[model samples]
Target: MGAATTVAQNMSLCDKYTTALLKDNNATNQYTLMILLVNTAVIGNYTTTPAPKNAVPGILANGTFDGKAVNLLPYFDGSLLSSNRGGSSGVSVNFLDGGGAEPLKKNLPANDKNSHQYTLLTHLYEFFGVLLQCSEYNKNPAFPAYAGHDMESAHRFMDLSPSEVGYFIQQVGLSAASFGVSQEDVTAVGNSLNKLFGYRCSPPTVVVPEQGETLNSICQNEMCPLDEKARCDLYPNNGTVVEPARVNGTGNSTGNGTGMGMPNATASGTPGFSGAANRMGEGVISLLGALAFVVAL
Candidate 1:
């Protein structure tokens, strides 16, 4: 089976573990958000590998999150790779890192201004939108409150789920495999996420809220207090708070609030998400072309 399928299969186990973790009243909502955020980072890394040729030099190397550089591979033009070398002839796509340096560029464009095959940032944006939705749902007060406060509407920020997150990570792995990213590099990301969140890697036994834990209460007590720095570290412009609502058991709300199963609550129009998928598709096509070229040679 494909890696994506394998990961999807494993998602059930992850859900189970997560459910257990959240069952404890002491298990803060931040923990769940942290899992979501860290997973996004790992998955986004997979979607765009070796950093884009055109991306700002040393940007990924620096490992900084300035809202402009972190998780932004899909939006970059492949031509930038050639420009770094002075021209198309100067660029070379070489797999396998060695010589105490990064790999040679084999798939960069010939010019610095041409349209890129894929844009990684786009995927991140869409991913962030999904997260926002989740955040919003957690915070909505019209639902039962988790902590003492009304729901914060922050859960709506996340549009993607843990399973979908796993799928994206696997997709990135497939992309990186095309470029010859080392098994160590790919596995390192996965290990990092698992460690960061204490992830269980098992499917959840219960997808619904725990007993006495209203969705709104979970959002307020468990989810909202999570660190904004953690979210921003994964996707730029993420973690920003929207409006708040009440946690009255009825689920009526006002003003762009996010609730469970709400329309567009985690909709897929975020620029980053769409852009990443588009760029990855381009990379896949490019890889196929390269394979054909090698056969012709």
Candidate 2:
């Protein structure tokens, strides 16, 4: 689609998203966070500046599709990212600096504190993953020995498309798209957005009993029940009764809840290494995957 069309469509979608979020009491919370983050980008309020009261550092979700370990923070720390505050909306975007001079954060210098960063979308996904503790089973610190999960899988959950990206750019009032722009760049942005806030689900990795199965007898598999009605921590015959995890701080643990929780001591990652390495694989790819669009297109 042409730039104008893309912008119009995304603005419409954003409008729909906003209306639904405001009107619907049960909108998914993670998606709400995603929408807000996108809106923040559109309005030019980058998450953090080079100064004080910087946003808290969050854990990276998982490894990239290419198997690179990512230590992501919420803001563009100037090391991996270079920002331009000149879009039509005057919002700032943290673009990946491929030719950055400093290495990734390994005993770095002052100048290298926050360089070589992931794109804005990547930061959001990492924050979401950390917020939800997606790597752990049922948000229990006891599960998922690794700190990070598969980010690629999270991207699939987001299920972003090029059309969506087009809308997003327009909604945010981005620069005009010139000739020869490829679809992959937009697709990649959508992918990053998906990881950040998409809620698409694939088949269950664990084998919980079907709906007809007795909730009392379903604990042997170590998987939590997907059926909201079936997942009772107080059921008589099962092992330790666990409450379903809550999303978006609603105090209810069931399907469609936003599941936005705070990071705790349970989060994976070394003291200096950020959170555990994100292992979400190729399907999700890297949030910075769209950098090619910025660089080559």
Candidate 3:
């Protein structure tokens, strides 16, 4: 029962940590968070819960997965290029200086037909891999809590595999060839994935002494003061260490009325630490300022 309770508490802590990790911008932090999750799955005892076949149906149903919802193709389609002057076209080519008319406005066949599908599939594949690894971790007995649940269920939902994951990565390259996300964004995501899966723990650095050496030490040849001897008289046979009282100054007193010498105010500028009202006021002010600036501009 104690083990079960500890596992439950750890699981809750892991959930909170994971949420915070997702919100972080650092790839290392995200990878560390994932690693923590994997470690927890490996070490903790978990109760298995049934999951639906379609792990990301919400993404599909909400149109986030396909072009219908998020329209990721637009971000990657190189043929749909926009110029500094706001001119739009599929591809730019400089023709010979002959009098021949410029070629009719057209889209790059490579970009329009093949690239989009490849890019979408690639994103899907990578996302699926992370999910699959999570499932595998859940299945391992090193973590007893997740034993009953099938991590493979996520695959049935997403319909992806290792081969597909590679194919999708290739597709991302093709997509990048067309729609140009800043190279930095692409690199960041790639680096994050690499680090998340690649990290290894180093061996322990410290060794502990034997129990007898640690437990048998009592009072050695240390000299004691008369006042200390008097205090020891209060609890002669007790095993607990008694801390001596402070002999000088206004012991432990703070000058502030609140005792910590700090203002009892919220960071949000409200009177109470729970500054819900102050936040609402700040939000309203920001909204109004934005509206006014837009109107003025």
Candidate 4:
């Protein structure tokens, strides 16, 4: 793509997200709105349900959450190889004694922005109309339109039980919700994922606390992402609230409906998150800082 096209693609999708975000004047509320949307999806119970509260302990005990050790189940669909999903790009992990949950990555750059191959962030970004060229996405002429990039294909091999599908959505949804996505968007994403699973997890129940656990306490204690800085609150947010920008009109990218206004939420929250002051401002700084810090590895 030419420079102008690239710029337009970047800004067009960004406008969709920022337009969605700046709708809320208070930066914190923006984050809250995001979670509400996400909440509807992971636990939407649109099709399947319960997510087995008793199962969480076993998964946690097995050190399977947050890519601690590879489950090699839900990914590697379509043309994608094990490396595309797993830390397969020469990635090295160092585990402390009983530290499977927090294994340290030794990969130089787990994700490369300049590369055409869609790494994690890049692949996720395209969901919001970024139009990145993914080496693993739709490379084969025989691959389907969204092929390796689609959630259904990714999880198809797993043949996940309804509960496993619910758990998968919950984990991914909670990860995005932490950044400030809403339940509507989260549900949109979840609905899309559920379709891949034949609505097996429709009407899914989000992973709630066993008994004594509260929302705050469950996430505060149980969530595990690569970023240690991720927290229970609208994270990567500015310390103070800021006035919402007067963004107007709608944002459409790549001439497809698959732009920022996606049905269920997934990657629309990446607006201005690269630590660039020219974008969404300071709210994204800390999150980007954490991301950059990981890149330093």
Candidate 5:
């Protein structure tokens, strides 16, 4: 948390997140858009290969929303990592959103630069996209189009239940603390993540559980090589078994499409809910920071 906090705080004025972080275009907010990009790149999210390149600048240049460009490339390049971490060689991130929501929500057109949510989601999507690409998940037989990293894998592992997803969010908090990421930034990310999970992306997603099948079984079943490597790397000697989701009738439950569904609502409005979305988001940032530390290792 300390290292990450420093990075967030020390980010230059031009590097902060577009809104709050940049007050009067001079005041520096801890969590800036550039911080997200820097963290994403540190975790090896940006692609340097390919003809046109999916590097930060190109992606922002090509992607737009609400008639405005989402370009933050000037603030981030392969050089940012070298300046901050003293090295430029990137590495594959070992962590992933257990619920698989990151991959699912990443491609939503609504999340494009047009929506207010774009700034936050961009980090989420790019971080996960890069993770998927650099990891074995990109190579899974289920997603052959990504063989050359041209296309992102579209497999859904609706393996996590609402409660489990919440737990993942909590993990982000712990991870962030360990890495010295600021609590304020973590809270902001938490709020954003909460909104993200319950965001109800356009063209609702429906997941049909395999009778008695649970999220844990799916996450644990025929695990991809990338996931296996990640689990080992992240958990190491600690026998930290991933938990399963409990779908009783409490907490922010992502409905199963049929009848057990609910719109994306906050914990205040909804009963038995604990705002797991924000937790998940904060954890993601923390995990990214942690991964960046790993890369530095």
Candidate 6:
């Protein structure tokens, strides 16, 4: 699609999204946080962020995607995140640097501090603007397009597993839905993001789930779910396989709602990593599978 057309489309979608949300009685809650975060952008704004591991934000539904260990709330210092900004909306992110205590901070420079974060939030504000198909984003080339990080590259070093990424994306939709975006609009937004994330799910290791391994996996298996296909992929089909004793527990026992309550579909609307001609080794692979499937899910 043409850039102009894409932006136009997104704007229309956001209009629908915002209009619906405005009509919702429960829209004032945290589910509106993401919408408020991005839609609040003016021509210039401060930005950068994440979801923390511990106390998962109540706005985000609990995720059960297979590999998710850490929640993705941006680091918070005491009351910063919880501080009631009330009804004022200007894009200013005051998230504190989590330092060594948070895993997402691993990729950031301790010295860079707020600078990098500011850039990130700026980009995200604009990216969502872009995601919303806001033409204002195109007003300047130096904005996100000129100086912004692609999702995977921006987050690759953050120690984010595919599931963590998936959780973040899943939450975006569910939260929006919780705030009252129509299911159709929510589904549309989710679909577009899934495609966006799939395209960006490259660099480092990009492995597609084979006919047997794929649980309708997209972005290779970057966010593959552990259902029949993933389960079979992780273990032998034979029931005789002996599982190892649980010596330690995984910190990723994150329990919220199921990840990607929405399914990430291929271009053909079939399950698994899209594409029709690429069948043979991939025959609509799994019965069903999902990862919050990011915008990266």
lDDT of 1 by residue, 1-297 (tens): 022322322332222223333332222332342233222222222214323211111111212121211221111211111111222122222111121111112221112222121112222222222222233334433222222111112122222223322223333333333333234333434433332221211111221243222112112112223432233322213333222222334222231112111112111222333443334322211211111001000
Q: Cα deviation in Å at residue 227, candidate 5?
A: 29
Please write out the lDDT profile of model 5 over residues 201-232, one tens digit for every residue: 21112111111211111111222112322322
* Whole-model lDDT per candidate: 0.24, 0.25, 0.21, 0.23, 0.26, 0.30
**How large is the C-alpha RMSD of every model relative to the true structure?**
22.3, 21.2, 29.0, 22.0, 21.8, 16.1
Worst 10 residues of 3 by lDDT: 288-297
Q: Write the per-residue lDDT of candidate 2 for residues 1-297, one digit (tens) a residue.
A: 123233323333322322333333222433443433332322222233111111222222111112223322111222221122322111122333332212222111113324333333334433333322232223443221222223322121112233222222222221111111123333434553443322222222221112122112211222322333332243322233222211233221121111212122111231322111211112232232221111100
Tens-place lDDT per residue, model 4, 115-200, is 32223322232222212122222333321122123332222223223232233333334333333433333333343322322232
Question: lDDT at 1 for candidate 5?
Answer: 16
Clash counts for the predictions, in order = 69, 31, 13, 29, 19, 16
Give the range where candidate 1 is weakest over 10 consecutive residues by summed lDDT: 288-297
Better of 3 and 5 by TM-score: 5
- TM-score per candidate, in order? 0.21, 0.20, 0.17, 0.28, 0.25, 0.40
Better of 5 and 6 by lDDT: 6
Residues forming the 10-long window of minimal summed lDDT in candidate 5? 146-155
Model 6, clash count? 16
Runs of candidate 6 exceeding 4 Å displacement: 1-11, 18-69, 73-95, 98-114, 140-146, 199-297
Distance from true location, Cα of 103 in model 3, Å: 29
Cα lDDT tens digits, model 3, 8-96, are 23232223233333333233333333332221111111112211111111110111111111211111222122111112222211111
